[model samples]
Target: MHRYANPSRFIRIADTIFPWAGGIMITAFAIGLYLALLKSPADYQQSEMVRIMYIHVPAAWMALFTYAFMALSSAAVLIWKHPIALLSAKAAAPIGASFTVICLATGSLWGKPMWGTWWVWDARLTSVLILLFLYLGYIALINAFDETERGGKAASLLALVGAVNLPIIKYSVDWWNTLHQPASVFRLDGPAIHPDMLWPLIIMAIAFKMFLLTTLVTRIKSELIAARVQNVQRSLHGNLADGRG
Candidate 1:
């Protein structure tokens, strides 16, 4: 793990894996969309409106999963000081933030027809909303300092602190009486969703996961390149100062 922390090594690995991940993401999304939008039957209750689930559910799941990834990476950086872990967390923040916004926006779109409202202050929705703020907050904090290291460390701390919200978002339905639906796929009694709907949802979820991985690698590559450029400039300046001295 530490050996791969070297930027060159990390870039080499990312270069190898990113193309494959991107290809798989594109393929999976194509198949998943076909299964979700074309092949799957409309819900007996919600009809065509349920089609929103294909996009909304996966975005919502990725919202939580991406934060978990960031929090864990932040923890690794704080505890073990792994530069790659920190860079990975930094790379993931914006992507996670975008997904969180999509989840909320799509949820509202789905909700208006079914619930007769565009938004509600339900427990599940509120927790997920807070999750969005957390992402933005992390991003803001990361850019708040003149020293990039200071900003990164401060943002990492915030990410770890905000992680407590993940479980709250997950169990909001169980813990509070809310408009949001309870767990259908992850219940102790087993999944409540039918196979026709379930398979497409699973496929979409996997596609979303791959999509995040694809973007994360790209972002990390950019970060590594930028860092290398900064280091080269700093070294040149230091040598010039020594020569003048």
Candidate 2:
């Protein structure tokens, strides 16, 4: 991992993954949407409205997955001091936040019709909301310092601390009586959903995962290039100061 920390090498690897990720994401989304929107049967209970799960569930999954990825990256930065780890965490924050917003918004939309409200302070809902705040807070804390290293370290530490919330969010539906349904898609016995709906949901999840890969690679490369340019600018300024003296 440290060997690939070289910006040029990492960019080369990213270039390879970018096109492939984009292609898979597009293809998966096309199939996933076709099945989810047109082919799958309407739920007996929620009817056509349950189709929203195709989007909402995948977004919710990605929200949690992205945060877990960030937490792991933060751990790398703090323990092994992986040069690219902080950059990866920084790159992922906004994407994860976007997923969280989608989850919350879709949940509210689904809730209004199903649960008779636009919002609720239920355990799962509240925990996921806190996850959004964690992402936003991490972003704010990182930018608060002029020194990038200091900011990254501080944010990394915050990410580590915030990780405790992940498990809480995952189990909130079971841990307490919440309006949210308990695990159905991922259960020890097996998925509770029928095959017609399950297939589309799985494909949509693949699309979302590919989307993350594509965006993360692009953002990390951008971060590396920006850092390189900043280094060059600082060097030039230092040289000018010495020449003047």
lDDT tens string, model 2, 1-245? 78977889999999999999999999999999999999999999999998999999999999999999999999999998887998999999999999999999999999998999999999999999999999999999888987567898889999999999999999999999998999998889999999999999999999999999999999999999989999999999999999999
TM-score of each candidate?
0.96, 0.98
The C-alpha stretches of model 1 lying farther than 4 A from their native spots are: 242-245
Stretches of candidate 2 exceeding 4 Å from the true structure: none
TM-score of model 1 (CA atoms): 0.96
Clashes of each: 0, 0
lDDT of 2 at 201: 98
